[model samples]
Target: MLGCLLAADGTAQAAVSESVFLDEMPVVLSVSRLSQPINEAPAAVTVIDRDMIRASGFRDIPDLLRLVPGFSVAYTRDNTWAVGYHGLADAFSRRFQVLVDGRSIYSPHFGAVLWSDLPVAIEDIERIEVVRGPNAAMYGSNAFLAVINIITQSAAQAAGGLVSVQYGEQGMAGLLARYGGGDADRRWRVTLSTQDRDRFEDTGPDGSGNPVELRERTHTYFLSGRTDWQIDPRNDMSLQWGVSQGDWRGGRVGEASEPARRESGAAFVHLQFHRIPTPGREWRGQIYYTRNHYDADALGTIPGWPLPVRVDDHLVQTRLNLDIQSIQRLRDGLRAVWGVEWRRETVESPQNYFNQGTLDGELARLHGNLEWRVTNAWLVQGGAMVEHHYYTGTDISPRLAVNYTPLAGQTLRANISRAYRSPTFFEQDGNLVYTDTGNNAVNVVTIPAGSLLKPERLLSREVGYVGQFKPLGLEVNAKLFYDTLYDYLGSQKLNTAQCNEPGAKKCFQSVNGSSLNLRGWETELHWRPLPHLDVSAHYARVRIDYEAIVLDVTSTIIDDDLPDSAPRNTFGLLARYGWDAGWQASAGIYQTDSITWLSDGDKTTGYTRVDARLARRFKWQGYGAELALVAQSIGNTYSEFRQENLFGPKVYASLALDW
Candidate 1:
């Protein structure tokens, strides 16, 4: 119904009548693999709809996550971002899983989401569902911290032609064109977009209190299309394909070592067949293939250095997946969903792996969820996943949740889950040794993958509440959690007989050396007064307590700063209103405490950011048209990711037309 209302505009909208009812609470599927209202789900979920997306004035989909509680989002570079949940923010530790239309996009090379290369346009998204806890019991491995499910509008829902253009500060320029058409039985939509942006004014501190500069400007292009076909009364099919490529300028003023062009791209093709034979029975089969490639090496002769052999980043990653699932009613007031998945992931790199040609991993998993209703106000959910991976032979993840309703619009929830994440390929078998241009060893060995690594384990427990205030049109979702992370994958300095250097004689390898206790509370508040006004707010507080399982690994103690990964407090508020004459205005306030990024990231100071936007809709040749002006970070300049990476005010205007 929300999708229908958003797609209708005003002409075909739902009539304003007493017979019509709108649900303030959302129904989500990412929780227990079942479609249930938030009050009944086992996890805390945050839904970002199209209305908020448009009003936020964010050009990148990642920036829109500021509205979600306990989410830390920052830009490490002009073309790269670090996104984390609760704690453990990093550029390489891709702990969480992201799904686009049920297709996982987690890369196999460095275990990171290729944010800059995502083949998705901001405007093409319909909604995003974020599950704010470990969901490995249903999503398999790598869904360690959370799961983000990005749902795009169907071809049928977006049947028209649209063109939008944007130009903003930092030399930001973009253009998008979309066309969609179909009949009742079949529909398809295609979107093509390109964005060109310049690097930030400052690229971070280069030590000596001096600013460092590299041409990190980027130009990106994307082409995404979707097709929906209704084969018969009981069958349907969907085809989704997307391609993206980006070129980033990279060079230093006096150095020839930085790669002149940083290249990154991704492509994917997905096909799914769905069957619904009865009202309470359904099944789906899907297959997908994805490829991601990147080339950005920094190697040049320095003024005082004699060697210019810096084996920088260059890699290719691919994934092929097949899955089948069934959802059905087991009995009265009872439901179940079962599924199986098989996948192959491969990574090819000469720099990181040295002589290793291609590294491959095969994985298979079986998962199931059951929902039982004991009474009119009591619901019990349980699920587990049995998975087999080349890295971790076989493992079982289990989850259980209980929900009780005390009144008409209030519910209480208690949940506990156990999950695991295997060490990434880079952490397992990587031989990351850089050599000189003459193939001679120029640097000492570090992080040599010496010791065997154990898969990280997690035990999470949470108590939550969901409430709806009918008279005030308000809905609240909140949770308090205590999680224990065991077998932490930290690096330990080890004695190596390889190239001996006076400055660095020891190498490092992954080890289970540290443990952590995460305590946090997060909440969401949303209120919408139909037709004119909408308000959304979020807040969270997190504290990480670190403990060492063993600090006697050699002499150095690593990962002690892991407890500083997240801030102590964060909050945000956004409000939008519509007035007469098709005029609309919106404002947002965001705040976060100081945070320290992990693995080469710097500790950044806390800052407050304010944004506002104004727009008006009109008819151009009888076609809907809108012009909007947005101002971001109207406050003073602040640092992000690094102290020298300054973030300043920006203003931009966009014109969107539907024909």
Candidate 2:
């Protein structure tokens, strides 16, 4: 059936068309901070362009990442998603790094990215570059397994105005508007967006519906703007600012839940300057500031109380980052990049820190890299970064890679690297205070110490291959990786009786007596058989072994087994077709092996699912309009995390106008 659809697309060449679409190219930037073909990239990489993003039929950024091999995207709740590269599968996957337009979006409070707080709209994205391997040498700490960079369309490219509206079942409604203008030397663009959706029906781990309703509603609002100015032919400046706010509710069904409601807000500003002093010599300087605030509240009844009690938890964090870099071309076939960065952060959250009203942290880093073409068939690249943090003091990360091109269209690469994840504010000083009122009794709360936390480290090796068939318009990339992690940080609660203090407090703290061994293989293939037809396939296999070696209350060191959710196998296939008559269709199928939920010891059965989209485009009075219908989980209901997280079929329609 899939082959027939691609073959039939050749006959409808004149029935459908798109205003802007491009084939997947070999160009990428995550490897060396410069545009280089995939065959020469030092590490495995994946590029998601605008055309591919549009055809995926995914409304969220995390969902689109599912197309990449080795990436896991799980829908934990109605509005919360957990994304990871190799699968620790926690609510906050903190090992990965994320950046938007050269500005880091990962928060220092928990060392996690707040996907829902990102201000940029999906329509404003131009491309996404993902380095599918550890790259701490180039990017700093937290670049443990992968690095994602999202690039938005420039004001000049967006031009005019665009409005998009979407409606669907389950009280889903969304709107996005963008306006762009300015001359060649000066350009600006502004965007506003909103989304609202109802909660899914209450269900248990066995996929049986409960009597009560689950509070899982979500709503969001965002506003953002960007500007660019060309000071001269050798210099340019860019500025950006954005704000995002949202409210969501989540908890178990048929229970009076604590922390059931959450409100989140984020604001940021970024400024950058680029200068080309001479040929083969370029320099850049950037500064960015971000503020993240969140509040979680809930009302619950106590056993002995006649009324419900309200509890509040709040966190506020602010960060300022500055960086300067220079790219120099020493000679033909030789290039290098060197940079320095400094970051300062401030936190004000009495809930998490208790009496500590506010605190500050700082970090400084220096890095350099060199890409040398040793010979016609051999390429060598090496880099290292040295960073100093308030908690861990100083550390160094280094990486080296060699690429060999034996044939015209084939390349092989071998890489070795060392990466580290610095401790977050929460891990270093979190209190995690909570009250339990049950059976007419109130238990004492625990106070924790995070000051002894240390950074986690990983040593990894990888081998990759990139092959291209120009005649067939096909590209294939495959990689095998093995990693050994030490001093893995984990949460633990110490017994109060073991302490010698007056209150003998039972404190929760971050511990480092843990380790993990992970191995994986992934492959991605892209084929463009025709101008209007495209096909892609991805597959991955992973395994994990983890051990928690810690000191117990008896002062004895013991190694305990830990649960993991790393799937043994996963695969996906996608196809898109377009006709000249303005008709287009896309379909995809995804399958995953059984996975264990580390939290509750529940297992999620393996399942296969399908998604599809169809659209019609029309032009009236020089304005382009499109109407599209999208469907997810076209077959029977399936669970991505657990049965209670069951996601059934959903259909929505959207209309977009561009002028």
lDDT digits (tens) for residues 1-659 of candidate 1: 11111111111111111122235567665677666778998989898888899899888877888989998888776367788788788875388878877888777876787778888888888778888999999887888988887777778767999999999988889999999998878889999999987635636455357767757578999999988887777777778899999998755444555576788889999877777788888777778899998887777663555767774668899999988888899899999988888989999877677667899999998888899999989999999999988886898999999999979889999999998988778788776666667766554455545555678888999999999998888999999999998887766655555324332456666667667899989999998867699999999999999964455554444667777888999999999999898899999999999989876578888999999999999998978999999998896677777666677888899999997
- At residue 545, what lDDT does model 1 achieve? 96
Give the best candidate by lDDT. 1
Please state the error at residue 322 of candidate 2 in Å: 0.7
Clashing pairs in 1: 257-299, 257-300
Per-residue lDDT, model 2, residue 511, is 64
Tens-digit lDDT string for candidate 2 (1-659): 00001011111111111221232346665666755678888899988888788888787887878888877777666346677677666556688878887777787877767787889888998778888988888777888888887777766667799999999877678999999999878888999999876635455455454343456778889999988877777777778899999998776654554467789899998877777799888777778899999888666765765555445568899989888878799999999988889989988775566566788999998888899999989999999989998888898999999999998889999999999998888778765443333212122233444356678899999999999898998999999999988887765556666433233355445667667888989999999899999999999998888756647744322224233567788888889999987999999888888776443334678888899999989997787999999888886577666566667788889999999
The reply for model 1, stretches above 4 Å from the true place, is 1-22, 203-208, 250-260, 302-307, 310-312, 444-448, 493-507, 529-531, 548-557
**Model 2 bad stretches (over 4 Å):** 1-25, 202-212, 301-310, 435-451, 496-508, 553-563, 597-602
Question: Would you list the clashing residue pairs of candidate 2?
Answer: 14-580, 14-581, 15-579, 15-580, 15-581, 15-582, 16-579, 16-580, 16-581, 16-582
TM-score of each: 0.93, 0.91
Report the error of model 2 at residue 486, Å: 0.9
